[model samples]
Target: MNRFRQFMSGRYGFDQFSQGLVILSLVISLIGTLTRSNILITVSYIPFIYAIYRILSKDINKRMKENYQYTMFINTVKGKFLKGKRNVTGTKTHKYYTCPKCKTTIRVPRGKGKICITCPKCRTEFIKRT
Candidate 1:
């Protein structure tokens, strides 16, 4: 155990993306096993190869950068999804519109009838029905 730990000390360790790859590969392998499909099992080897390559890689800096970029991309997608969900669910009590001049998203309380809205960034005023 000590020897194994010492050997891996300088190698790139696991990250979220690596874990995800491992899990996805496992799921695919399981599906292939349960269904007795050779092609799916072959396809599942792709992520495992990448994950193993990352684990054995000695270039720690590059691996960390790759993980960081992946995490940031996932976070950006999650943020967009959450924002859209909120917009859809808040229609009962709130209204969302884009400023025509600057295309900025603006949220206003609902049931105020026709209201005048002024853009704080572009200073463009427009009338909107909420």
Candidate 2:
């Protein structure tokens, strides 16, 4: 009993933001289920299950051993949660926009207008309004 409490209190190095996201998703799912809304239930369950899976995931080693591809996917998801945003590659000096393709928030120059923006992750190109 005491050990369990201590373990819960001790920092397991799990991302708090992701934990919160999972909780939020579960709550929404519960609400959807109670309300009998199939659409909400289905959509909410995706994040809910994902959040639970991420929270229960022990570490990179276990994740890698279980499945490298899935480990990478979870790591990417964890990165987004920990960083509070997705990865973005662009000039540091310029203002940036989020890449529509990969959802990576990019940085671009302040006054750059009609500039072509490319996402490093998905390699999608689009114009940024700056």
Candidate 3:
């Protein structure tokens, strides 16, 4: 145990990006197995190998940057999905409109008859029936 600890003392270690890579590798491997595709099975080893490389890498700063970028990308995707979900859920009670000048999305209450909508971003005025 002491020898193993010493071996890993300066390693970059496992992180979220590594975990994601491992999961991706596993999924690809499973698909390859189900389809019995040699090419896919060979490709599946790429991510697993990269993950192992990351875990054993001594470049802590570079690994941290890579993990940060991966997390940022994931957060951006999640934010977009959540925003879409909120828009969908609010569709029953609100109307969404885009500003003609700035293309900003404005949400207004539903059932308002022939209302003049103002865009908060670009101060554009438009008339719409909700």
lDDT of 1 at 121: 85
Q: Which 10 residues in a row give candidate 1 its minimum summed lDDT?
A: 13-22
| Tens-digit lDDT string for candidate 2 (1-130) | 9986666562333454455567777887888889998888788777667655655565646534445565577789888786554223333446656777677777666666688878888999997677
Error of 2 at 54 (Å): 23
Whole-model Cα lDDT of every candidate shown, in order: 0.93, 0.65, 0.96
**C-alpha positional error of residue 119 in candidate 1 after TM-score superposition, expressed in Å:** 2.6
Q: Give the TM-scores of the predictions, in the order they appear.
A: 0.86, 0.30, 0.85
Residues 1-130, candidate 1: write the lDDT tens digits. 9998998999998888898789989999999999999999999999999998999899999999999998999899999999999999999999998999899888999999999998888989999999
- lDDT string, candidate 3, 1-98, tens digits: 99999999999999999999999999999999999998999999999999999999999999999999999999999998987998999999998888
Q: What's the true lDDT of residue 126 in model 3?
A: 98
Best by TM-score: 1
The superposed Cα distance between candidate 3 and the true structure at residue 56, in angstroms, equals 1.0
TM-score-based ranking:
1, 3, 2
Model 2, residue 96: distance off in Å is 2.8
* Sequence-dependent TM-score of model 2: 0.30
